[model samples]
Target: MAEYSLLIVEDESTLRRLLEYRLGKEYNVRTAENGVEALALLDEEIPDLIISDVMMPKMDGFALQTAVQEREDTKAIPFIFLTAKADEESRKKGQMTGVDDYITKPFDIDRLISRVNRLLERTKIFQTQLDAKIGQDFSQKLTPKTMPVVSGYTTHFYNVPKGHGGGDIFDWTETRPGTYFITIGDVMGKGLQAKFYAFSFFGYIRSTIHTMLGATDSPAALVAGVNQALVNDSTMEETFASLLLLRWEPEHNTITYANAGHCRPILVSERGAEIVTYSDIVLGLTPNSEFKDTSISMKPGSALVVYTDGVSEQVGKSDEMLGEEGIIKVVQNAYGHAEPIDAMVQGILDESKHPEFDDDVLIFWLERLTSMDRQTPRWFSPFRDVAEGS
Candidate 1:
């Protein structure tokens, strides 16, 4: 049986000891003399929930709540204020400060314990659901359960929900060793209808990529075929997408990319980060426009990060963009040596000064192939003719 820990902060010795004694029967309880002491304890280890007196010297409950709310780690911790003040103003202030609940000083022990347990349970459930939703969306890939053996080149995928699910799809497939194809498309509109449109567009793009695997169609012609397909058939009348098609060839250490009204792909290399942009209009809107493809030689230890407009155009806490520069800085600081890929992703989110995302963010990291993996495929038969003759 695991014990749920509870932290109690009260300036009065009698109340602190009494509450700790009663609650300690079921929970592992720790008491603090005041907010300052409680904060110090928090530094040592986080408690499942916090129950604190409203008034105290060297940091009142209000001040403590404000402080905790300012930090991301502490903000979500359930807060309950134990106060003697029954006045409307004090209660209003506590409510405004976003304390989960308030109990008058002469409180009922059973009720307090019950509320605390409930809060913790609800928090766990919400987080569980969030995890489930993310898992369900990215159904195909496991999230880096094993650390990437090679450093630098890795791809990260995310599912960002737009209103009612519009036309946004991003995918990556390894066609051959050291060769990968990345596809991103934004369908026009929001909700289930838009999601339907996006799904169709994605299928078309995926099929086209597969069909053209050994064929020589430039990115523009690929887009033209997709656009013409959508326009030619009335079933996809509502679908229009800003598409980007990119291929990374490990053999030549090069990246061939083309964009159709999509955001530029930023490369984080040994030389630092730089954006690679080329001209191509949005797909599906026009049927016969020519598009050009561009290519770049990849450095051995570089990462090509691509995203939908969501990330590049996101508005941060200060109302400024979590721009390309911000993303680059975050990636560079977190992506040291060969840590686990999930660590790198979480690190970026942790470094994000603000928590809000104005738009969906998708980050893909393409690391260069290490020497070990760049070897020739062992299963290919070079002596098939000789064996047949014999």
Candidate 2:
């Protein structure tokens, strides 16, 4: 059986010690004399379950539960009110406060233990199901279902989500004829929570792009619009996301890109592979953040590679990470291959020596095919009205 941790907060010294001693046998337990001490302990380390008294000096159980529920880090911890108050009003208040379980005085220790076990087991099962559902949704929606076919350009992307989903997200759309807008981002966490945040953040990105259509064509302006929206939203005040936006113009053979604390993209051509040099603060940091766009000229057979940190941070067999420099090497080696994007992914997997990555892996490759190379017609239309000759 797994050893779960529990926190017991009670005013009575004898009762606190007795509960701790009994619960300690099945689980690791910590005790506190009052809500203040319980909060202090919580700051140090969050426990799986919190059993607290309703009445105590300094801070009462209701106050302590409010504090715990308000914090993002501690809000999810299961709570139980074990107190002497057995009134119907007290139980109603506990229920309103969102206590997972409530036990009155003269409670049987065996019954209490059983309730604790059931609550913990239920929480574990709920988390597992939530992760599975979120992972399925991520696989279906977070990544592009099909690569857009642009005239004079060949596009390819690969996304491998980590266990139960991860934070990486990417999207692309043709803003105008011969112009394509692409955005890649990574939310600042992992697993189901990060995946949830990624979906929300990506929604903001898409909304901003559409809201600013025809108003601005600069990548920096689009990124700034998204940042402003994120920072101004109270719910997203604590959420931070690294974003990279690119505007590709096939007729001009140029790409104008803006980075918001994201990994710099690599530009691979006949000469060699090199990283694009431009970046700014991440989104949700501040509304006043400034973003700048850098334009780079591309030649035939040239390609741009944008990816999440998962690729650059992969730990290799040497126990060292495959940093940006290693990524450049992978792109360079894969250049000119019949399937360069697949070659790059295989090279990365070979170096990592892992069947799957620890973080979500997303890679977007855009190549300006040469005249001699086979070309495909543009079949993707961003606007139905425009496609229908309206």
Candidate 3:
């Protein structure tokens, strides 16, 4: 259950302390001298509900209500007007301002508490519904499991939400012929906390990628920018994210990539499979952190397998983890026969064992085509063609 937070806005000192004492037992309470102080507090954090005096210096209850209702963030916060006046006109005016209830002064403490409880209960229900709707929308945004044509490469991926519903997100774009950008990240937290961070940072990265198109060839710089963006968000103090960024250049026949505390990607070819060991600090954990790039020359028919911990840490029938070494073994066994991109994934999952995943799972397979297989166009919309298949 969410612990309710109540902001009491009253200019009078005596009643403010009394309300705090009475309400603090059942809810977290904050006190403000007037509407002006309340607005200042709101800039820091919004409360679940508000109780405000009708008459006050600087800003009155009606004025505060009007201001709160004008904002998208504060509009739905349950509000109650505390007034000494009981005139019908005043009550009607309070209702017009979107006040949830009006409590007349010299009010019975018990009745006031009852009204507060009911409003809080209703607000909680409304918030849960809103969260569910928004979560569904976020799921849609993260739904792409595969991308389309990227010159001489094919891509495939999978996303499986955990029981608590975390998001393991990935995206890629070929900004120009022979140049490509790809990114994958696992968001911290679970359920609503995970959804909030997942949606928030997804937008950040999406916009950042667009802004970064053809501007620089450094994947490390983009990862550093994403890290700085997370550090700038005050709410991300306890949250951290792990991500990987990749940029492919056909002229050099090489891929430049960086990892920010994410699981390493495995490279598989006729020579065998090996994990790329590049590493850096996780995003949102360190301010002004540095991430270095690792470049690899691709052999024809080479395959790259990238996945979140949900696959690496998955428990098998015997409760053993399918760790990085296990992933290496799986790739080695299938390296010769594996297709560059398949709905089954660039790699196989059941070979890793299809155990019940305890967290969200994401796996991406990227393959550089051999000369014999390079028949497709230079580029196409990966999202429009392949995302629906997965």
Candidate 4:
């Protein structure tokens, strides 16, 4: 029942006006003399559907359709071609451009209206279904349902996709009691395709972790394993991903991490916030890429923060990005709050003032709790003792 907008591009004044007057009764109609004028109007506002004539003075319907298809915003709009030439060649050309319909001159007005209505309705249905599917997939696959509970540490994560879905993914597993392995990555691109690709990439990462968990505890080795798997797979040969792998060993009070072209993690302690500088090439780029691990000792009350580019690249009021420096400031400010992780996430959101992000936003915070702050029961003590060879 939503009133759809339609653009009619025809050189003939009488026929254009007649179609507009008739179509205007059921939907919003706008008329243009040729494809050039139609494109100008499109810059101001995109219509739900476009009906264009095959021949015109400045730009014809085929040329106009190509121009519209070139833009990301206007490419999906339903298009119909109207023409005096009923030749098979012209019809084939229009079809090649993916026009919704082609009607010859002396076409029935009633038939034209019916085709327009059917195309618009089909488009609406398709969009609705796509949105629903993306929403469902995002909730079920891309994000963790609950924050991880690790002994001697407070762990929290926050994620918001740009729209219905995004490319960022994060997951954690308790390799052994009191020891955790975490993986965070961003697939290259956006929207539904990126979301699905991320799922596939994460699947490979998970399988690598499970198969190698008993063999080695090195993050760099695990990252190299994942990269090799991706390079070997024909389906993922062209896919690129930035991965950050971290292993938290509470017994050692240290975090061992490896990066694959991902953003450097921020370490906040008595020395102050500083970026961890170790990095390597992204996954799926080369077959024999090597990843190096960096180990950082964490004192009680210290925290480590990792995030996707969306957080650091957020545009501020001055049209500048809130880069790593801005994120460090936010993390430092959140230290005094009862829930530092939640406060840090909120601080970034308030600073950006963006209701929706341009890319997928993800923040993962891990804080080593001081002895005085340890209130939760230690459920991993048995596993901890075994890991320590006691």
lDDT value for model 1: 0.71
TM-score of 1: 0.52
Q: Per-residue lDDT for 175-257 in model 2, tens only?
A: 87878888899989767778878888989999989989879888899999999888899987767999999888888989899
Q: In candidate 1, where is summed lDDT lowest over 10 consecutive residues? A: 139-148
Model 2 clashing residue pairs (backbone): none
**Residue-wise C-alpha lDDT for candidate 1, range 1-390, written one tens digit per residue:** 447788999999988898899989988999898888988998888887899898999999998889889888888889999999988898999999999999986878889888988998897677657655543353222112332232335545555564433456777677776666767767766544565567667778878877876775466666767777887888887677788887766667777878888877777665677778676888767767668889988776677766666666665556576676776666666554464235545654554556544444455566775554455555454576567668
> Per-residue lDDT for 251 in model 1?
65
Question: What would the TM-score be for candidate 3 when compared with the true structure?
Answer: 0.60
User: Using Cα atoms with residue i matched to residue i, what is each candidate's TM-score against the true structure?
Assistant: 0.52, 0.70, 0.60, 0.67
Q: Which ten residues in a row have the lowest lDDT in candidate 3?
A: 340-349
Cα error, residue 253 of model 4, in Å, equals: 1.2
lDDT, candidates in the order shown: 0.71, 0.88, 0.80, 0.86
User: Candidate 4: which pairs clash?
Assistant: none
TM-score of 2: 0.70
Q: Which 10 consecutive positions of candidate 2 have the poorest summed lDDT? A: 375-384
RMSD of 2: 9.9
lDDT at residue 280 of model 3 (Cα atoms): 92
RMSD of each: 16.9, 9.9, 9.7, 11.5
Q: For candidate 3, lDDT tens digit of each residue in 156-194? A: 666766435676677777777778787888887777678
* Per-model tally of clashing residue pairs: 5, 0, 1, 0
